[model samples]
Target chain A: MAALVIAEHNNQTLNEQTAKTVTAAALVSTPVHVLVAGENCKAVAEAAAKIAGVEKVLLADNALYARMLAENMETLILSVAEKYDAILAPASTSGKNYLPRVAAKLDVPQISEILKVVSADTFERPIYAGNAIQTVQSPAGKKIITVRTTGFKAAAEGGSAVIENLAATADAGLSKFDSEALSKSERPELTSAKIVISGGRGLGSAENFKLIDKIADRLHAAVGASRAAVDAGYVPNDYQVGQTGKIVAPNLYLAVGISGAIQHLAGMKDSKVIAAINKDEESPIFQVADFGLAADLFQALPELDQELAKRGY
Target chain B: MGSDNSMKVLVPVKRVVDFNVKVRVKSDQSGIDLANVKMSMNPFDEIAVEEAVRLKEKGKVKEIVAISIGPAQAAETIRTALAMGADRGILVKTDGEVEPLVVAKILKAICEAEKPDLVFTGKQAIDDDSNQTGQMLAALLGWGQGTFAHSLELTDASAKVAREIDGGLQTVELKLPAVVTTDLRLNEPRYASLPNIMKAKKKPLEEKTPADYGVDATPRLKVLKVSEPPKRGPGIKVKSVSELLDKLKEAGAI
Candidate 1:
């Protein structure tokens, strides 16, 4: 049986992570099948079919699936589970939310946020806030896994796959989604951005966050916050970067006024290049930093901006 | 259904240093040791215990049994849960770090004996941040699971769990005999009162060994060394905010 990957996309467009998920799926099984669940998501499904290594695109279109609610999704995915040996999803919020339920229903262990696929049944993942690496073998009949998209390259585009419609299952009337207030920003998302500039509690107040924002805007980078910043009310909870928060692996990560806590490092330690700017040389962030600048961020922000502008970025 | 047929609820708790503790990397670069570290109940696990207690309070749950897999010191964590209204406690004594898979295997054996209707665990342990044991145990038992849950409700035969997802939230409904992992926003756990703490001392706490479950508590990953992270250079404070701005420009931080 082929590996089945759940596509992360709205009806209109597919997410980049879906392709990375396909890449991860290819490691375990042959002829990957991508499942796209959304309302009127034919365009998205068609796009998904073009990803290399995918043999089929299973489309389940229904109003109940418009929001990808776990109730309806679990039913739809479980209906098709018998035909696949493994079910994979990117370790995003959506995957983390529903994959475990699927694992439960299948009576299999769900490997969450795997960093490496050692084999079809064995995997390596970070434990204890990335302090320890664990390699585990699933003792169940089927393998259920969530892949961290950053660990693999997105599959190249342009391959034809069969797109078949799958019937939606009966809706499980569970919790009602009250509403969502998504942050609107022109900057790239923190997870997908190539460059990220984050601020820590040292920024003092929410008002001082603009300093980090200016630098981020100048570099066309996403703005992130440490848990300290979020706890201090300097930013929303979504901006928090740590073990309990968002994990990002970007090309360049710059930390300003942040004392890098171990929890915070667990989220971004995989970044390609790290830069730290803080008044305290004793801050832990400097240890991992490729470039360390010991200066008050208040004085460093304008200098960074001026330099970037001079370089025509 | 008769009261005798009610399902058991098993909750596992852990002791961690306070999240607010300003941890400093030791100069030797070895791993952070908690010998003198101020410890508290793992925040997410506290939420798990709270949810279990609430279910019992509402009469939806019959009995709440709390367990902790750690050194004898972990008894303190179990006592905290008992004070929160758990019916009994189990301490699986071990020293040092226990591999998540080994822990999961042992828990699965315990759950098999208890035959719980539901299981609750923190989404991840704060100290190691490994979010594996709950899912692994669910798999080992062939039960359903809902992870990173922020809200949950019970029905006649299934559970409705609200889980925190990236960019939004997703809700899953699963049949009973499920595992649910708690996140921070699940609830603000209540503090144990004096009487409750005293009462917890008398609550049943059974001690067991990992060997009882036929699982080896050996670690798969070995630490070659533990060292403090590197240090930052001295800070150069600018004379004024404008001067600071100028320095930022020079450093390209802006």
Candidate 2:
């Protein structure tokens, strides 16, 4: 029995999470099939077909799936559910919305945010906001899983898998999309970025965030904020990175003015290299940081900016 | 709207380790150490109960029922909800961790009997962090769902919900008899007043079992192990900004 990976995309460019999810799916079973369901998402399907682990791309291009509503996506996935023993998706906000519905309709339990696939029937996932890891064994039958994108490397792109057109489309007429107000940013997305610079309440005010922004612009890194900073209205809610917020695992994560709360640590503890700059040397963030600098960010920012500029960054 | 029209809302709450307390894995590796841990209503579920209460306060809803599925101690969580303004509560007495699917199925049976127009829950429980029950319940009832809702407005037959997504916010309109899971920005939950706490003790409370709903309470996923995540090693302090940059560059982090 093959695994079915539901691709994450915006009908234009395929999301990097899909490739990572395909890698996790391949760990469970071979002949990995990716279901690209959206309106006019041929390019996205083509991109999925090029992922290394995908064996087939099933494209369901229709108006009904354009928004990927949970009710409609559940109906569509069930139409092709027979051939798959496992259904997987990246645990994005969108995937978290729809996959549980599919699982419920199938009368199966879902394994959320799986970090590792130990075997076909067993897996490891974080619980209590990554404070503890629980290894779970799924009952024999069907497995529904959501992959934590940071856990697995993105599958490489070199193969040419065939894309098969899927004719199934569904509309439950239960909900209607109204409008969206997405934050527009020129920087890289926080979850998938190579480097990230996050500000905390110690930065003082929304206007003072420029200190973090200038460095982020120089390094071409995504900007994130501690929940305290976001709660203080220094940034929008989406900029928050912590428990109950976005989880990021970048190669280089720089914390500025952030007091590391346990909730905050839950999100970024997986970073490869962590650096923190704070006046309080005893801050908990220093515990997890590979490198720490006890200095006032107000004075340090200008010097760091000057140094980076001198180095031609 | 006729005089007989009375909108009803059902909110489900879970009792878990309080948000402020640091959770620790048990020495035996069975589960979290909860011997003396302070237990409270899951924070997200508290928001859900508050949302329902606000609806009833505005005369948009006639009744608000809070429900919980856990041990006998979970009844106290329901009392806390009642103090926050739920009209009544139903406690499904179950012993251990009930997976989201089973919880949803039990809620489905409760919905059939209660016939509430709206079901509200915390987006996810802090313990398991499985954001699945509301969507699963919505699926089992063949109704629409709005998850991670930060803002919601109700009409006689529809609900307009503003949800928080990864990149930003998205709004969706769901028809009547729907499920809504709340996010942090929905509304600040009110502290249970001392007077209300006394009144909640007098409020009607009903108890049942999972067997009453005819849903098996067995867990499908077996826990092979429980362990602490690897800890980050101690770090070195750099004296100057230039020194910090040099060390970062040495580690290929620049």
- The DockQ values of the predictions, listed in order, are 0.18, 0.88
DockQ of 1: 0.18
Cα-based lDDT at residue A199, candidate 1: 97
TM-score of each: 0.77, 0.98
Per-residue lDDT of candidate 1, residues A1-313 (tens digit)? 8899999986799998999989888887877999999999999999999999899999998887887765567778999999998899988777765676577566555677878778777777665566655566766467788888888889999899999999988866543354454566888889889889999999999999998898888878999999889878798767877788889988888899999988899889887767778899778887787677788888787877776676676
| Model 1 bad stretches (over 4 Å) | A138-141, B1-10, B14-41, B50-65, B68-75, B84-87, B90-120, B126-163, B168-180, B186-196, B206-254
lDDT of 2 by residue, B25-88 (tens): 9888898999899999999999999999988888888899999999999999999999999999
Best by TM-score: 2
State each candidate's chain A TM-score.
0.97, 0.98
Ten contiguous residues minimizing lDDT sum, candidate 1 chain B = B223-232
Among the numbered candidates, top DockQ falls to: 2
Q: Cα lDDT of model 1 overall?
A: 0.79
- The regions of model 2 sitting more than 4 angstroms off are B1-5
